[model samples]
Target: MKGNFNHFKILIVDDEEEYREVFKEILDEKGYITKAASSGEEALNILKTHSFHLVLTDLIMKGIDGIELLEKIKEEYSETEVIIITGYGTVENAVAAMKKGAFTYFIKSHDLEELTIEIEKIRKIFYLENDNEIFKNQQKNSKYMLNTNNKKFIKIINMAEKAANSNVNILILGDSGVGKEVFAKYIHSCSERKDRHFLAVNCHAFSDNLLESELFGHEKGAFTGAIEQRKGRFEAAHGGTLFLDEIGDISLSTQVKLLRTIETKKVERIGSNKTMDVDFRLISATNKDIQKSISNGEFREDLFYRISTIIIEIPPLRDRKEDLPNLIEFFLEKSKLELKKQIHTIEKKVMERLLSYDYPGNVRELKNIIERLVVLSENGIIKDIDLSKYRVDSERDTKSREEKIHNNKEVEEIQRIRSLKDIRSEAEAKYIKKALEISGNNVTEAARKLSISRRQLFNKINEYKLR
Candidate 1:
């Protein structure tokens, strides 16, 4: 009565013909689309063919009772709420049903007023959920509204939308700074869990012990400095979405615990014996080649399968260069507002330079570049500035192309030609050196930029004698 009840569909599951007809007739008269199923099996069959907002089922049935039906519905169609219908004698069983995820239970009576009240409550919940999702979408518009024209990226967006409607664990893979976490948040914002907390954790940013405590929480005195009991990301994200960034970087031990928690939907805090049940959609992301990590025994295969029910791979900025102009404009406006600069025009030469350079740090690098330009602009005009000051490798890229052309000419004029393998090795060495330079000679960071394991990069360095 409080909300639009016409959109709500109710399934009445009862073996008794009279009760089924009575429930259906009552709900239909109340303006709810109602369907009747003689048993739990019939209800499940109906569910496969159609969607329902709620299911009203009798606790005592011939086969596949109310509790079993509730479990199946929660396991599959989790968005559908269930209310158990019990006789006076089976009230205890109905209570058990509530513990197992039933919305509520009602005793059979001629009055049937309690049934109508329960349905109204569910409708109110639906109304509130719709309002919350709309509000959240509006709040997140500026932060997550990534406009792209690339066809492949558009398809990825469509796939993400479909994935959002279901309760599936997602794994987003891309290079560093390619907006994997942003995509994860987009999925969360488009999901039924949008109204709830969207908690994110960077797995690569913490030590093994700290990461474990951060994910599973820690009681007071759990460790040397853990003076107070604190809830972890998983607990804090209950009934919402938990985003694990750089998921491939987590240790195998932590992976094992994560796998168990995901499987059981429960977690035990450090120094606490009690296990708390948590329900949260998992959306993990990593720039690393996860298959290589699995082959190298750095990540668990079981955990990978569990978290990667739906995998979304994002293209690097270089591949989707068509979106560069729009992205540049967006970042330019954003930077202007943030820096409080009245910069109005970007020089043609400056725009050309911005478009030509391959963004090794993807969108994030472009944003930084725009912000830097805004900061350096004089007299409200953006003129050609020294890109090298920002560590942009455009000059180095041009020199590399020149050197490559010179090398090709030399190879053609020489009597004895170099083998293809040798040529490839030389090119690879130069690229690795460039990556190292871009990462300030930090081997770990260079490896990440190269999309290879640190050990693999170290082996390549030794093979090329570059270190």
Candidate 2:
């Protein structure tokens, strides 16, 4: 081991001079560049002037204590790994120290053989990780198939690819269901970190404290129910990518921590003084208007700037109607394969209806609509009649009529002429169809959308011959 790792550096920190000397002598014999500190303060002072790959520190020290020293080293020298040594019957603190970012811990009373083996194992891991990163960086560039029919949409994809080639942070702006995560993944797959971890965290899903603990990791005893130390997204995504979805939803306090971590390239786990170094390219997405969020004091402006060094604003489906045909074809094929159906054609009128509607849910909604059509199709071919039952005619037509009514007396007269029951029936039918469309014809989902029971929706579908 010494022959192979002669260049590896190790630091030993112990208040007891004899123990420090003994450890240093063993490490020196093994050909490790060894340094010793009699106290935590001395260790820190040595660290300020020099650097080491690993640290061997006693759990109980006279001055700063091993835990505090571990934290300071981890925060300052994130690349440096620490291993805590404990006296007899202090195994729990050693374990706790491991949770606080120690690479591994050792029993002070034990022989140096076990400690040497652990160090050797860690050395192998470092080599493996470095080799893996190199392999990932050498893989062929990932292909991107973004819709290029719309110039603005094409521009965004092109811009994203350019940003991906660099190590810059990116922020994606778009409406919900607009495939922000997909875009993020595309960037990751195309980036240098293609084969590395690509972890995504939805900021809105967890509470403030939970989110903090989740992103920064936490000690075993960090909070209630934190039974064991856990690595967070940031740690796990080191040398890779981290996609923070719905970033605007994070609380102000968490934002501050996140900003500091991004600036320092370091993170402190909850209930742990240690700050670990993380090297990840962050890609954040949000449907919320971040500018508005900043003005509302809901989001941090400086943090936003740090995150949005390269911003890609995705166009809504409505703005990219030219891509509808291509999108429809893409989704149509996807749905067919997913549903295991052979849908070869769609009627011209059905295509027209699909292309005309303004999809509030964007591409996702369109994909669901195509899937619903495929699931509900009786024949292999999709036709006007099959789509007619699931038409959004009522809602679209109603809006048109309302607009006309506001503009013309003749439209108002026509509305007045219709019976109340007829108007109500029209609305009910339109809403039921909309619900069915949104739910992909799943009775349960349609019912939920309509705020009706499954049985009620079934009854309405039968009564209206909606099937």
Provide the overall lDDT of each model, using Cα atoms, as 2-decimal numbers: 0.85, 0.82
Candidate 1 off by > 4 Å = 1-145, 391-467
Error of 2 at 208 (Å): 1.5
Q: After superposition, how far is residue 409 of candidate 1 from its true place, in Å?
A: 20
Least accurate 10 contiguous residues by lDDT in model 2 = 136-145
Off by over 4 Å in 2: 1-145, 383-467
Highest lDDT model number: 1
Across 36-89, the per-residue lDDT of candidate 1 in tens digits comes to: 999999999999999999999999999899999999999999999999999899
Q: Taking the candidates one at a time, how many backbone clashes does each contain?
A: 0, 0
Candidate 2 lDDT by residue in tens digits, 1-467 = 24447478888999888999999988888878899988899999999999888889998978799899999988999989899999878889888888889998899878889999998877777766876675453332112226458888888888898999999999999998777877898899788888787788878667798899889999988889888788889998999999999999999999999999999999989999987888999999999989999999999999999999999998888888888887887778766875799976777778778888888778767776787788777768787776666543445765886787789787656766778877767877877887776677888877754434576677778767797
What are the TM-scores, per candidate, against the unseen true structure? 0.58, 0.57
